[model samples]
Target: MSMNSHAAIAPSLLARIGAPVRRRAAFLLLMASLGLGVLREAALGDAWRRPVRAEFRRVLREAAGGGFSTIAVTAALIGLGLVSQAIYWLGEAGQEGIVGTVLVTVLVRELAPVLVGFVLLGRSGMVAIVELGAMQAGGQLRALQGMGLDPFRLLVLPRVAAFAVTGFTLGIIFVLIALLTGFVAGSLLGVVQLSLFGFLDAVLRAMGARDFLLFPGKLVMIGALVGLTSTITGLSARRGDSTATLLPRGFLRGVLAVLLCSALLSLAV
Candidate 1:
């Protein structure tokens, strides 16, 4: 083989090898971050606890104000889809009774968290990372340090708490709306018997205490993963000249981190 051909092949081969290693490293780092965050939360007792709690409250307030807008918009879109599916299934007879069950299970267990996380990733997480990156680049973080303020406490902590609370709350709301919309559509279509109690029973029976526990657990882990990964990636961006490349790479890493953490936790459950 010609040296030129070998060189080309080597680059492609190296790229293939590097991709998996990078993914694995990102997954490992995500797990480490989750472990470290959980440990810190446990060890600090009330020192960081009050601030985190306060930040979470603040986040909920902000989300209550602004999160509604996004939730409303998402609800409309999701409601339409759920309703359409319910109507279609209702035409098939007794399957309509399960519409509410399907909606709740899919929305609460899967769609809501994943969708809300992705939305916040784009809406909140990206903005947070960029803003913090810019602040660090402009020496604001350093200025705060000089002013004797802890950047972690002032910046990272609140955002982390906010993301967890907001993401989880929005997820729950999304699921509720989806189920309700499905139920209404099923009733309107006159398929089977549309009883809220029956639907609730189905949902409750399908989702055990373990499932309920796991969903929130996954959400919290995903929230922390997004927060820490974004922070580290943004901080790293300060040292680089390529904000464009760094931002996308950071976003992808953050998402992958969330998925990895969720998958690992699922395995343990």
Candidate 2:
């Protein structure tokens, strides 16, 4: 072929490949949003509905358990991070007092949401994806159709609710623990006043609602996105080589969604 024709053909081929990829991605996101909507609708459902109450209770229980486990893991990670910061600042005089401020900034505004999101993205998001993927591979999703059940309601709603609640709760707990750890470290090292209440007051004043609200909002958005993305990706998983590709795509898409939402929210606030 002529060089110009070859170049044109290459562009056309690339566009053809890109189009389906983009469509699939968009479809995945659409499905995730639908999952969130389903959860919202269920929450607004009947007051006298026994099934709704049972589902709500089950979701809350799962969220509490997940939040507790997430808190322990987040605390350990934040503690390690704080210790590293303390050691680094130890060599510099007159720098220890700022540790409390640093901790508050990191924990309340940045680390907590991102860390909790990542934890859920890995734990809940991945698990949902794998479970659904396995089901898809095993024809279980089709089986649900045969049984006249909407898989999104039965499978995806509970998870979306659980992840959203767990993520927001864990984010709050992570910030609280990080603040306490920073205060104790500073006091022990004589870097800050020994009063916990005083430190907390300072943090509250510095953090205003803008900083505090941004992280929690981001956590909720991340949870919602993770639930949606994982479910759609899992549902789309086909047998053979396609399943492997779908799994990683789901994870990377979840991470990117969280980062994008967090950044936008932070900027807007």
Candidate 3:
């Protein structure tokens, strides 16, 4: 081949090779940008306008309220089985004094945050994927853009904020439900020797200063990560992409984000 032909083919080959890298770079760039937008909205009271507040409330209700039943059912099951088993085994082993420490370390600190993350990812995150993906695929996002409205500000910012709030609130609720149900089951099975308040108090005492930060931090970070993942996945949907394509992609991303972020936060803090 001639030098000119070689040059032309080389550029084409390089473009093909760099395509995945370029896509990744773009994804990270948008993720960082959207994260900053969410932080800005959170740190500034001025960012919460009437319409934004309205949108925030709407998403909050949908995310927290809509996912409550799922959270309750999961918590109850964990409590009935895992909590009861732990109590029975510890009592039998004559190490019941450390029940609080074991439960706090294993259940509250680790499991709760990750479970809450999964719940949010499965319930609210999927909904976000569907709604946002539909908007993108239908060209409605472009129509909104032409109308001089910022979809990122009006849609994404509010939704992410709601997710963060939902994460924290729902996490606390899950912990309470799980603990209560577990205590009741243990008591009925004659495995629990302490009163209800005493059992709860022991768990509270076992929690160190770090547990306080770890619990909320993991959930909030997980929530934000899941929110961003779902939004980006939905918005990235190509024109011809169907719901079948979008859902699996969004779900895979959300699950990975929740698990990875949960693990990272557990180690970092």
The per-model lDDT (C-alpha) reads 0.68, 0.71, 0.89
Best-performing candidate as measured by lDDT: 3
Candidate 1 Cα errors over 4 Å, as ranges: 1-35, 38-46, 49-64, 83-101, 240-243
Q: Is candidate 2 or candidate 3 better by lDDT?
A: 3
Taking all chains together, each candidate's TM-score versus the true structure is 0.77, 0.81, 0.91
- After superposition of all CA atoms, the RMSD between model 3 and the true structure is 3.0
Q: Can you write out model 3's per-residue Cα lDDT over 172-239, one digit (the tens) per residue? A: 99999999999999999998999999999999999999999889888888888888988999888897
TM-score pick, better of 1 and 3: 3
Better of 1 and 3 by lDDT: 3
lDDT ranking from best candidate downward: 3, 2, 1
Clashing pairs in 1: none
- What is the lDDT, from 0 to 100, of the residue 197 in candidate 1? 76
Q: Which ranking of candidates, highest TM-score first?
A: 3, 2, 1
